[model samples]
Target: MIEIKNLKKVYAGATVVNVPQLEIKKGESIGLVGNNGAGKTTLFRMILDLIRPESGEVLSNGYNVAGAEAWKNYTASYLDEGFLIDYLTPEEYFYFIGGLHQQNRAQVDETLLGLTDFFNGEILKKGKYIRDLSKGNQCKVGVGSCLLQKPELLMLDEPFANIDPSTQFRLKNILKTENKNNGVTTIVSSHDLNHVTDVCDRILLMEKGVIIKDIATSSSTLSELEEYFGVGQIVTPEIKVDKEENH
Candidate 1:
């Protein structure tokens, strides 16, 4: 379970995100949807402890995520290409992560069996640095590595941004399988409603860094969410600034 209390972040003396409270239970999948720069990535970064929050706490199963190293081992995230080691091949990256988790090659191979088709037998081959791989292939490596350890809490930011439709569908099934069988708590942030609706048990809608709507997918329709986001308010292009640009 993940609990966030009054979480807030600031950049250059300006408030970038604030969430009063939120609790995501075990085996639950949640989706975050917002316009560009609405703080979805900021919130995800805070949860993963990659970025510090100016105020409040994030707890995973009673462990303070921002206060301990144990949380790092149990929390797995794949937000962008930087998460992958650009200098290493895909197989090398997997072996490196496996070593960190104290897993042998056979165990790593077993864990990676589900992804073999995606790798197309090339991930085990040598000679290609991760940076030389295509964006979609890089994402596959990042994702495969994150799941290599079977962490309890999984967080992904715009995971389907560069992947193809077939892989996106495969990823959706993989997320569902993980959540169902392993009871992993998953939080996914995406701009695409179809992706979210396909896998998320709950949906949180953000506007200008504030969560304006939280709906249970079982009880809500996609059209309802569309109406909420499409309220005809004029959102200026001023909100399009990237996180680094704003920093």
Candidate 2:
């Protein structure tokens, strides 16, 4: 569970993020969707206490997230590759992260067993540093590291990006299972409407740093979002060549 009240962030005389009041309950799967410069990432950073808010604060359970270290025990986030220790191999990096949560090497290895499908046989024993792996593989490592903690709160930014379609579906199953079976409070941000709707029970539509729409997933939700996105949108034409030209 998380709470935000009058949260605001300003940069160069511009207000980037402004959330009036929001509360996510335990076992809720929430998704944030917005275009570029929409402040989704900013909101996430504020929640993680990575950025200082100009006005209000984020609270995890009953404790303030910014000043208290208690939330770290129950929180795990993977916003980007920066979260990974690039110099370390994926195995090393995972063990290191697991250690922080009081997980020994064997425990960490056991936890990794469930994640083998997500790893797709390319992650473990690859003998390659995380930085040397492809972007998608690196993403797998980051996600695996987060899940290893088994935190009460899990936050991921653009989790499906760069991952292949098959792997994306697998990741969705993992998140959904964790939320349903373990009651993990999950929050994720993505640009793909279909994917977000499929994974999250609730979705928030953001624009210009404001949460313009918050709705539970339904039969009509996707259509509503598609309609809204299509409004005021223009399609620029691209040059095309005939099939016979090459021949």
Name the best candidate (by TM-score). Answer: 2
Task: Give me candidate 1's TM-score against the actual structure.
Answer: 0.90
How displaced is residue 98 in candidate 1, in Å?
A: 0.5
Looking at model 1, residue 122 earns an lDDT score of 53
lDDT tens string, model 1, 1-247?
8899989898998777887788888888989988887889999888888899999999988888878787777778899998888898888889899999999989998988978766656565757999998888888888899889898888889988888888888899889988888888889999889889888878887766777667778534478767756885544324432211101
Q: What TM-score would every model get versus the actual structure? A: 0.90, 0.93
Error of 2 at 241 (Å): 46
Per lDDT, the best of the predicted structures is 2
Residue 15, model 1: lDDT of: 77
Native-structure RMSD, model 2: 9.7
Error of 2 at 159 (Å): 0.6
